[model samples]
Target: MSSHPTSPRPVADLFAADGRLVAIPRRPARREALLAHLAETLFASGRVYREAEVNEALKTVHEDYPALRRYLVVGGFLARTKDGAAYHRQRTAPLPGGATPSVA
Candidate 1:
């Protein structure tokens, strides 16, 4: 008998046929996973991005760039300047429910 641990849903499954995110998950765990995936794929480490650059990058994945941007910042996936003019991907980010993601 073999038992396997439950695996997280594939990040790709969250996207629609058009290659855009269908919807942002409401559940913290699921949402956090999605956000982390986005952060990894969308932005490069150690590179500062202008707000418009971030928006343009996010718009490729979802029509609701504003909400996605807010989530990324609020979820700690992306750090922003005080003026909200600059953004960059963080190496480690806090998940929802106050849990930090494990660094690999």
Candidate 2:
């Protein structure tokens, strides 16, 4: 899927500089890349992330605002909540008999 959502521009096509990819100083597909990127960062913690905090952390890598928002919401890398956002960190397992899976 393209990062633009409305268009066909893939995030990989967005570049850092000529002949080299910076992965920061971002453009259209910036958010699309965030989930996987942050996962690599927060892997050891196994914790949830609020949207704003996530953006702040990502800033060290990319410098765009709108693209970051879109990536978090549209990319399904994180889930938004009334309090803020949580990184998608857990796997769902089937419940026994008729029970529903645990929710946080």
Candidate 3:
């Protein structure tokens, strides 16, 4: 993960006034937005990570690394091998109605 992410507009609203993560939203629309931003911060394109590596990276952001990792995969921002040993950033796929799932 890069130390900083280039500011995408939606990220402006996700951070608290003191520049800490307030919380990851629960609503699908808002959560997807936050997850997409998080995906960018945690994974680089063309990079593959072992499960431990992924968890360590996520731990830097939140205590609930497991949940964060799950959301990144389920939200379509990351992918894992069938064996579940490796993970990578994936291109965000469009939803059923042709809307891109990643908010950024």
By summed lDDT, which 10 consecutive residues of candidate 3 come out lowest?
95-104
Per-residue lDDT of model 3, residues 2-104, tens digit only: 7665554475576777655667777787788888888888789778889999999887766788998999988878888888888888877545777532222
What ordering of candidates by TM-score runs from best to worst?
1, 3, 2
For all candidates in order, the CA lDDT equals 0.87, 0.50, 0.78
Model 2: ten consecutive residues of lowest lDDT: 86-95
User: Each model's TM-score?
Assistant: 0.80, 0.43, 0.71
Query: What's the distance in Å from true for residue 11, model 3?
Result: 2.5
In candidate 3, how many Å is residue 95 off? Answer: 16
- Which residue pairs come into collision in candidate 1? none
Off by over 4 Å in 3: 1-9, 16-20, 93-104
Greater-lDDT candidate between 1 and 2: 1
Clash pairs for candidate 2: 31-71
lDDT score for residue 62 of model 3? 68
Tens digits of per-residue lDDT for model 2 on 30-91? 53354555545543234666666766765655576446555655655445555554544332
TM-score of 3: 0.71
